[model samples]
Target: MRRYLPSLSALHAFEAAARYMNFTRAADDLGLTQSGISRQIRNLEEFLGATLFHRSGPRLVLTETGANYYRNLALTLDRLEEISIDAVRGRSVDSSLMIGTHPTLASRWLPERLGAFIGSYPDIPLEVMPAMPSTDFETTQLDVAILRGVGTWLHARSIELFPEVLAVVASPALIPPGSKLDPLQFAEFPLLQNAGRPSLWLNWLRLAKLSYSGRIQGTRFAHHEMIINAAIHGLGLAVVPTFYIRQEVANGQLHMPFGEPVQSDDSYYLVYPERKFHNPNVIVFRDWLLRSLRKA
Candidate 1:
């Protein structure tokens, strides 16, 4: 038994005619003569065994059945178009965004807030990759990157998230029993450092208008979080971004000695290639990030 189906061309003819409700306009759209469009529409109505259009008077109007069929057929055509585009592109019809972020944001900032994005875009799959913010976008699959910087990324568009504040923190055991800490005493304890940010302590001191003549050095680490951990274990006093250790400060895992937080010249930024300015995935993530971070 042959399933009921008409020539795709005939269905397209009827759809176009139903769209304009005028055979002449539909014929012009499909690059066919009005007679050809009328013939195709007739073939379609004959196959369906239904009068799709009322032939009363010269004005053509879709019948009740034809109007209902047109609604469902329009949806089917849209789905078919999406499937065709996705098949050619080899990607999900529902967009998927790959984000690159540094360890601090990826571990501390993003984890708590990403669920909102997931909830909003349940249809869009999102993947967060721990990567340097300045990683090459041309060579990577990452659609967007969130990283800390002074906001001058050439060839990339950026939106400022928040300013960074560095503070001197230490384990409780490292501080001696005293009310006022002699600024010079800072040199006595091993200064925890991250090789990636060797100037953090120097710049922080400069901002505080304090100077240490002694060698400001200690166990160097590649990652910022590791420096925080070293300071927590009493290995040394560490200078870190105040934002990363909010819970630690509240829970007494780390203590900030008497001093104001040092504000860096840089801030965290959400960035992507300028070429991706209008990419759907990047646009949604960018808007979501700005709203989420700015609100908090």
Candidate 2:
């Protein structure tokens, strides 16, 4: 028998106790008495020759070693539960693929293209979640994420899908017939802004080799989709990603006042945990995504 291998009951007790940081709550969760929970944890600690918790009155706090152990153990327990559930259901261990991405990509880019991936792999259950705040494999169950960034995420593998190419666009009504406006002239109009990228207008002006001292004032929106929609309604000139407004531009809903799209330093990337490099679902989705984008 392995000396380091603690009993399942002790492990469960420690996990529950650490999570709640209250032995009574842990006992209630596991249908055990408070003392029973305490005894299990104590025995486990003695077995490991390490104090896992610091008891101060009624409150319990995890020690440094305990915190590290809990993080890894929690993940292991979650994976074990998933595998057990799959086994009971008579399916593969990893039966689902959860993808996290921004709303812009989810609504505009993915909705039209998801069907192809679904058609190719019917067995893998798919769930698309909004990558709110930030996506972290350690903290989230997401198998993969499509994020807009410079292609660098800690403890994760990232592959750039495409560089962010921006273009100055406005409603056709905003731009008169056969009229070309220079950078300074275009700045005179109401310039819509993306709240996330507040420096976009200033950067574009500097990139265009012009310095405007006026404060950039407009209705700022959180997402590019909102900016595009606002631009279509003739609110103001919106600088948006060129690829995002392709259909809008082609269908005469929005018009580009600029000659060519400006490439940004950031790019959209397919990011995933380094551990999931060999995941079949991720691989299939990655390949399909690249092929689809190339065709588009």
Candidate 3:
């Protein structure tokens, strides 16, 4: 039985042409003449019985059908290329583990502990990518991810790592060394804010039982690391996760006047696609991560 599929050469030609929207550039990319790319795309369109491009325009444009086709086709081509490369290298289908995590955790917390994982499993290759906001396994090639939330992601199995512990810290110059902070005094100084987590200060205020009514005029930072750096420079008071600021506190760069750390409802979780529950690499990594963090 013949499969109803277009030729690989024609598909490649159309994909490249659609990506650059210029036959000359696509031909240059594939080391072929402009006519060759155009002919291949024409053949592909004829085979599929659909108009893939608008030739009447000043610049080449993909039709609605062509755009939809390209989106799915691109992902398929990428997966095919990955499998082909792995086959050429004589490795198993799932030979490597790609982990995605937030930039904050990757830069501050993970590096020191990664060495132990490498030393233990020298045979397993690893790649770390910065996954912002959230992880979508269907759209990404990551085998596992570390996320901060309540372990409620759809279609993913989440393993709780640790609950978030926050501490109110500021430069010693701003609050003075060895001075205790009163709950109401929180509104006295400028409050630095995390743009990503706007409710952090409000939540902390509620937990501390302080009803702040004074106006807060402070700079809002996009990243948590920036907020920590700003607090270190005596710009304002910042509430940061204790884990990320342990070194700063130990070195007296930041003073924690608020005595007790505040607990957050969210926890850090190691998550993977529910379908990957039986995958050997995912299992190995999950075990290693849980064990490593447990001892920390």
Measured on C-alpha atoms, candidate 2 has an lDDT of 0.84
* Superposed Cα RMSD, model 1: 20.3
lDDT of 2 at 238: 86
Per-candidate TM-score against the hidden true structure? 0.66, 0.70, 0.72
Candidate 3 residues lying further than 4 Å off, grouped into runs, are 1-93
Backbone clash total, candidate 3: 0
| Model 1 lDDT at residue 151 | 78
RMSD of 2: 7.5
Q: List the residue pairs that clash in candidate 3.
A: none
Candidate 2, residue 171: CA error in Å? 0.6
**Candidate 3 C-alpha lDDT tens digits along 139-258:** 456788888899888768888999888878989889998887686677788889898888888777766666887666578998788998999999999988888988999999997887
lDDT of 2 by residue, 254-293 (tens): 8877656778878899998887889988898888888988
Pick the TM-score winner. Answer: 3
The candidates, ranked best first by lDDT, are 3, 2, 1
- Runs in model 2 lying further than 4 Å from the true structure: 1-93
TM-score-superior candidate, 2 or 3 = 3
